[model samples]
Target: MEKLNVNPNRMELAELKSKLAVAKQGHELLKGKQDELVHRFVDMVRESKDLRARLTEQFSDLYQQFALVGAELSPDFLEEAFLSSGNSANITGSEASIMGVRVPQFDFLLPKDEISYPYSFSYTNSELDASLRKCHRMMQDIIHLAELEKSCELLANEIEKIRRRVNALEFMTIPQLQESIRYIQMRLDENERGNLVRLIKVKNKIKK
Candidate 1:
């Protein structure tokens, strides 16, 4: 309940009143914004949790598939086979605005449209082929996971910022303004009473 340092005059009182009005309005707007941001943050957190679970399952499966394929082939041959495929995952991403937070949008460039395997069927074993297909499938989920992770990060940061601002207005700024207004009113009233007392004394003297 800290009051601002201010004079006890009508001009200062009017100025304080105006400030209090604006402060209250700003506090209301910030409270609304804080609620909205919290809602968004909670929603994103749930999404991220789901994505993480799915990604964990997928990655575990993918790793097991890779390990099985690795045991079936020599290291040199495995490297050669992977190199012969010449297929790569190209990623592109952009910024998407969600509640003023810039989240990421991701897409993958897979060779599957023109040629999925991009490798010779004669030399590669069935294990290699199967593992490669699984890898390709996993890349899509990996990209989606990336998008979710980034969105979660941005939302969390934005939520923190909004929360801080809301706290400042609700607890500090508005209270200080109201306190200053009350102090100014008390001072003005006291001054008015002193003037009235002076006028009464003058009247009494004139009568005497």
Candidate 2:
């Protein structure tokens, strides 16, 4: 702790005390915010982990099913079927506030006939149908995972910033202010004692 560069007087002492009070209050508030942010960050990390695991499993299954379908079907037919698909997807972007951090939100939109297969069932194998259906169904999950990952990144950055500020107040600014206050108080007390001694000397001289 270092004393601030201020005159050792009552006025400086009062100012330092006031600053110390404000600093402490700020530290508490920042600490609370940091705790809340960390709690939310941990929850998001778990959610992101679970979501990624699920997506990885689903993707593996989808790839196997698609491989089987490709092996049995002609490339030209597969390309035509996929090209004829009327399904289209869109994402809408928005913002959400969490603990003063603005994170992104996404809405994955699909057509009403998204589940409708463009290719005739008589021409396509059942595996192909299943693969296509699963692909369309998992689109929303993919978007959700992206949103969660991005939110986690943003929250992590915010939490780091708040942590630094809290540390500064707790370890540096508050201690310096307190030390300055103590120094000024000691000086004032010593000055008061000296004044009292001088008054006693004056009274004795007058009495003689």
Candidate 3:
């Protein structure tokens, strides 16, 4: 640890002590922030994992359903039906703050009449109708999963940044400040002893 360049005097010692106190206080604050950020990050990661798993399962089932429906209908007819369907949504994006980190939020607004199949129901079987309905209903969950994954990414980045800052304060700044304070105190004490000895010698000479 390197000592700061300052005069060996009471004024310098006092200043160093004050600086050390501030440094320690800042270190504690940063450590606290790092811990809290880590906790939240872990929780978000778990949540994202679970959500991803559920979505994956649901998507697998939805894919099989679509495949079955495809087998029953002609490719051109299925394509035409999907193209004519009037399923649409408006997605709105916004921001949310978690422990000073801003993450994204998304919401989808459905039309007043809700999603409707404009395709000819007479030509489509029950399987096709069911698959289309499920696909449209899954849109909200897909958006929610996207939001969670994005938030997790953003939170992870923020936690890494805080960890670096906390490590710097704990391992470098605080230790350096403490070392400088100690060096100044020792110098001041030695100087005080020298001055006292000099005064005693002058008194003895006058007495003689």
Candidate 4:
């Protein structure tokens, strides 16, 4: 708790009173913002959970398809096939600010060439090619969802920090300041009453 120095003059007391009012108002606004951020963070967590479940199911299906293709196709061969298909990705990242916190923005660019997967091997049939294509598409979606989940986590952490600060000001600092202001006011009033009594005594002496 912080204590304000008691001023002899009423001018300083008036200024302190005004400052106390402003601090109270700021505390209320910050508390409201904190509540809103918490609500938004909860929603993001729910969304991230759902996205993760979907991504897991899609990935499992893709792995089963790969297994059916047989071990004859080397991992390197599959990678090369995917690469040779002219499927290249461009990932652009930017920064977005929320309540003075910077969160990441992810942009995915898939050119027309990236959409087609071509196979060079004679054993590769249309079913295999179609499965590979679907897997590639799912991979892109997974990347996008991962970025979204990460951004949400980062934002939630920042919002929590802000909430703590707001709570400190609202529940602790502002109340302490108001208490100090009241103490100062009471002390000043006492001093004024004493001075008035002394002045009256001196005036009576002069009259005698």
Q: Best by TM-score, which number?
A: 2
Q: Model 3 lDDT vs. the true structure?
A: 0.83
- How many residue pairs collide in each prediction? 0, 0, 0, 0
Could you tell me the C-alpha RMSD of candidate 2 in Å?
A: 1.3
- The C-alpha TM-scores of every prediction are 0.87, 0.96, 0.93, 0.80
Between candidates 2 and 4, name the one with more favorable lDDT. 2
lDDT per model vs. reference: 0.79, 0.91, 0.83, 0.73
Instruction: Pull out the clashing pairs in model 4.
Output: none
RMSD of each: 2.3, 1.3, 1.5, 3.1
lDDT of 2 at 152: 97
Judging by lDDT, tell me the better candidate of 1 and 3.
Answer: 3
2 versus 4: better TM-score goes to: 2
Give residue 49's lDDT in candidate 4 (0 to 100): 83
**What lDDT score is found at residue 40 in candidate 1?**
79
lDDT of 2 by residue, 1-208 (tens): 7788999988778888889999999999999999999999999999999999999999999999999999999999999988876677789999999989999999988768548888888888999989988998888889999999999999999999998999999999998998888888889999999999999999999999
Better of 1 and 3 by TM-score: 3
Instruction: Write one digit per residue (lDDT tens) for candidate 4, span 50-130.
Output: 888988987788777777765656677677676665476788888876556576777777776345656664856565675
Off by over 4 Å in 3: 112-114
Q: What is the alpha-carbon lDDT of model 2 when measured against the actual structure?
A: 0.91
Tens digit of lDDT per residue, candidate 3, span 73-157?
9999988877765866799999998878899999878875555786877998888878777877788888988998888888788
Model 2 residue 121 CA deviation (Å) reads 2.2
Give the range where candidate 2 is weakest over 10 consecutive residues by summed lDDT: 109-118
What is the TM-score (0 to 1) of candidate 3? 0.93
Which ranges of candidate 4 are over 4 A from the true structure?
A: 71-83, 196-208
